[model samples]
Target: METGPISAILDTTLAIIFTWVGYKTAAIVWKYTPYSYPNARINAMEAKLLSEQRFNELAESRTLQNFVVNLEDTDYRDYLTGISTYNVEEIERSLERALAGTYELMIKILPGRVSPFFRLMLEEWDVRNVTSVVKAKFRGEPASDYVMEIGPMLPKVKAMAEAKSPEEMLVILEGTPYEGPYQRLLLGEISIQEFETELYRMHYGKLLSYALSKKNDERVILEEFVRLRIDRTNILTVLRAKAAGMDSEKIKSLVIPGGSVKLDPLIHVEDLSMALAELDSTRYGKVIRDVREEVEKDLSVLERALDKYILERMGELTRFYPLSVATPLGYILKREREIRKLRAIAKLIEDGVEPERIKELVGDVA
Candidate 1:
């Protein structure tokens, strides 16, 4: 055989093997990539069931008995029916259980790959649970009651609840994404509020990384939504800090990165007007500007505006991307908000608060 021909044959054989391996690997990935079509119909149906009218009616019911009776006919009946008393504590417990149930349902329906996103969403609950545990441990109070049984973080949450000290709680978070923040908390390097912010930062960072790893239109929408959420969070934090008379340096330290709003202008903001001016050019500028007057009256008003803006934006994304994960995500957020509103109404009614006042607090679901 000629030497040149033999070399060429060897090269050709190697190329064919490598090409076949690449093709097979890609085929495997494609087979398990989790297309959004599997849950499209389910997402649409769920969104329809979360109508504003349903929430409005729940909010309108004057008495606990009336609220329970009306709720029995809704999807939340399973969670609410178990409550035999109208006590605030019982109502809060029922609301927590209902939220846990919602997460369980979401995990069951979402594809395995898609489930991670929902799990990341559930990290909020985990952070709250951990915060409650840390506070309880600080105050020497029992915390097992506040631990939420949702997502993979539940084990860590349980461990933290049983922890005797902040250091012990930090140990419970070891090997998890939250370990770094918890360690900082143990070292007294960050306040509890700052630690909570760090947990959120970690969650958003993980979600952003996952979204970037998937190069698809659906992931693009998800990534954008995540960015908007980060922006909303940062804005709310700044507003709250300002309301509490915090300085600019402290406020800047609390602002999480990876949001759509640039950091340069925000870092120099010393007051509400300055913050509004800095955010005026961003996507949320118009909404914040519109509510500036109300925000001055009460900083909490700005928080509501931020929530409504994010919810409305999510709703828009769901409408535009009905066949993607956006719809399911939108439904999840809307359902969570509805649950919160319902819980608030139940609490107010249990406290004998005025009906008009309760309605004002519930706000417009639409």
Candidate 2:
């Protein structure tokens, strides 16, 4: 045999071995990782929760009292029963407590390595708490009761909660991820709404950075999910801004970058129809097209459609990739939506909102 042929054969064999080893190592790492995800159980639970019967039962609830009674047999019974009163405000607070408790439980059950993702997800709660505190501080009202206790940012939230003034809160936020948003607020560079939007932008930026650093199949899935989320968010922002009659520049400023959908055309559109037309060629085109009639009925319809789209996609991912991060993440997202649906139903019931209207607001089962 020629020496060149022999060398080529050996090189090819070594390459195959290395590739096999790399794949095996990755699989082992994923399987043995510290996440401790209860993937199968969570997926099963999600399936049960979204079943048609369960959704109809929830949608047909006649009153907040009735809803609470119906929840007696579900995991939410305790949380709903914890409400001291049937008033909207009390019900809302109890719902927050329930959400916080759920997050805390998730954090406790998940491994430390995987906990960061949940913690990051919980940062929205932290942001809401902080916003409440800052507003209350400015208005000279008590806010400590509004601070949530279920995120990696809890310690900072607590400190900010204690701050006597917005200025003090800003000082506390210094050197943190939130500092820039607060600084912009302090300098009159952005409105309160803009500040909140910026905070969300920052949160998603961090999430994207974390996903990219993983450099694995899980990361690819997560990045796609995050990008879709960003795109939906941008679309909603555009629609809302148009409804509010915001100037083009302001609307453009609110559009977050890095979404899979190109937003440039939509952002500059003079009207909602124009924006929808721009979205006609994107991956989400069909979603917006299907909801166009509903959108004409009320712009809020897009919000509901976007949410449904995201959940549907997540459900698909979980079903196809049961062993991946998709399972647990999909469960978490669906669970959160369930909680929101319950809260909305309770609030609507308290307000004597019609069952049909409430059903519309709650949207599809998931």
Candidate 3:
């Protein structure tokens, strides 16, 4: 295909036009999307609320009963009403609708430049759906009741229609991507603990590979962030298992392959005290600082501590990288925070918790 003079000129002109359009589109996005200032303010607020002392206190307490510590706003009332009204069917419908709208938005904004960011955002949603399905399968939940139908994967409601046992689940999921993990667990070749550990590793490992495949600069940072989050999760998981009387062999089998957890230190930790000491020796030492007291007294404290830790960490990252993938990620975190706040307020209002107690729970409620 030899290009004539006119054809060459037209091709060159179209190329220039497309390049300019792409540049202008990206410039507009860059200008409007830098919510770093607001993010920073929120991060500061989080730091104040989740100070080291506060974190230690949360870790020491079993109940997040303080979730609504401070309350004066009717906003919480509406939020609670909304949450209370959402039945399982309603939540599934809403999640599907939200995912469809988000995917449409992603397709529109994802020029060559933003494809990586779009995918990074989608990864979180993917994990949510996968985790939901896997758990649903374990509990013999119905597909419509379990799977959120908004992703690249084909809908498999029929496949899981009569799955009431793990063995039944394996037969149903035989050819699906989830089959391998489900089978590994169902066959007794692998424990549920190992299945959970490996499944998450596979998800994040795929995510990291996807990020690197994009060959983008900011994505490198996002990948590191993903890795760090996974490490924290694994650490929390190990801590909980130790509390549950899991042998070191089981703990080792369940630890995700990658990240800062060295096999030797992990193997040496026999009890909660030893586990905390070993954890203190790792890079996450700062993350689990002074958490032993809580681990010693109540295991539920670890859940609160982990939640507070991730919230604080994500809040900080949202501030640091406002316009990039972190902004949307932060928004997701904010939405979660809002949901929890709603739940807390609703529980408080329903239980008629004293205003003073509510104040202590949510902390200077608005």
Candidate 4:
């Protein structure tokens, strides 16, 4: 068995040759196979064909049945959950959580590459919550404790800083990112009107800026929504000021400059209450129409009427734009509606109001 060095080298070369031959044969077989890299064009065509067929099938089945099937197949079970017979407090809590879940899903599904217009609404909600908490803290009211944590402005810090009067709070906010409105607050000088104007300006300015930055259909919808809301807000502001016996000039000063109702006509009137009626006759005539008797009795009724009117308009918008930013905006509205309904229900139920009455006062079932 003792082999010479040349013989051993020859054996090794033969082994190497056989290994290379086997590899080459395997490569040739693989190349000629149906599902191999060399047949990549066919594979790609087949994949495309399959995808088209599936898409056609989906298109054909795009009905309630398919929707139900998709819901069953996905993590959408909770969306279908309903509150039928729960007590008022329980129903309120459940709806709040559901609304929160809706927003969470919205934030999840919104594309990372989306324009900022789609996010303007959520931004407004955040700012509103933060500003409310700040104002409440300055008033030394308990409302500060209920601030939602998701607001853009740091509420806790702002609340702590605004623990003094609103004037002091405005000074505290100076030189920060929110300083512009704070400066305007000092100049506009609505001491008797309170700083509600400043808050409105700050929040709406943020929304307006965000909306203007985008140039598309989404931006159009969002901007319209903001404009409508601001108009309604100005109406409420004027009505409230008139009811409170504030002078016409002061009330006009509080009006946001670009709203539907002009301050020029409003400032000319001597009687603030009469001015409010004239203003309503022209602009918000419809909302105050049915409540005219109530307004004559007490202007406070007009404020509630305006609130309901605003909600109705917002509800319509929600219906119109379900798949857009309007959906999440609807969630916020729904949550607020639930909270108000619960508060109303709690007070009425304690008064022994019938369940039927409770339901009627709140709304129809979803």
Each prediction's TM-score versus the true structure:
0.81, 0.83, 0.62, 0.55
Residues 210-263 of candidate 4: C-alpha lDDT, one tens digit per residue: 666655544655666666677767766766666566777677657765455665
Model 3 over residues 1-366: C-alpha lDDT tens digits?
Answer: 676988989999999999999999997676445444544544453343333243233233233233322221322322223333433343334434444454445445534454455554454444456556666666666544655555554344434544565567567566755678767766678865566666677767766666656544356545655666667677776777777888887777777755646656755577777877887777666656756675678755555565566556656765665555554445444444444444444455455665456546765221
Higher-ranked by TM-score: 1 or 2: 2
Model 4 bad stretches (over 4 Å)? 1-105, 111-150, 155-175, 179-194, 270-273, 276-283, 298-335, 350-366
Q: Residue 131 of candidate 2: its Cα lDDT?
A: 77
Candidate 1 residue runs with Cα over 4 Å from true position: 1-40, 47-56
Q: Could you tell me how far off, in angstroms, the CA of residue 212 lies in candidate 4 after the best superposition?
A: 3.4
Residue-level error in angstroms, candidate 1, position 90: 3.0
The best candidate in terms of TM-score: 2
| Local distance difference test values of all predictions, in order | 0.74, 0.74, 0.56, 0.53
Query: If both were scored by lDDT, which would come out higher, candidate 3 or candidate 4?
Result: 3
lDDT of 4 at 257: 51
**Of the pair 2 and 3, which is ahead by lDDT?**
2
Instruction: Please give the distance, in angstroms, between residue 264's alpha carbon in candidate 3 and its true position after superposition.
Output: 4.1
Q: Residue 276 lDDT in model 3?
A: 77
Provide the RMSD of all predictions against the true structure, rounded to 1 decimal: 5.8, 4.3, 9.4, 18.5
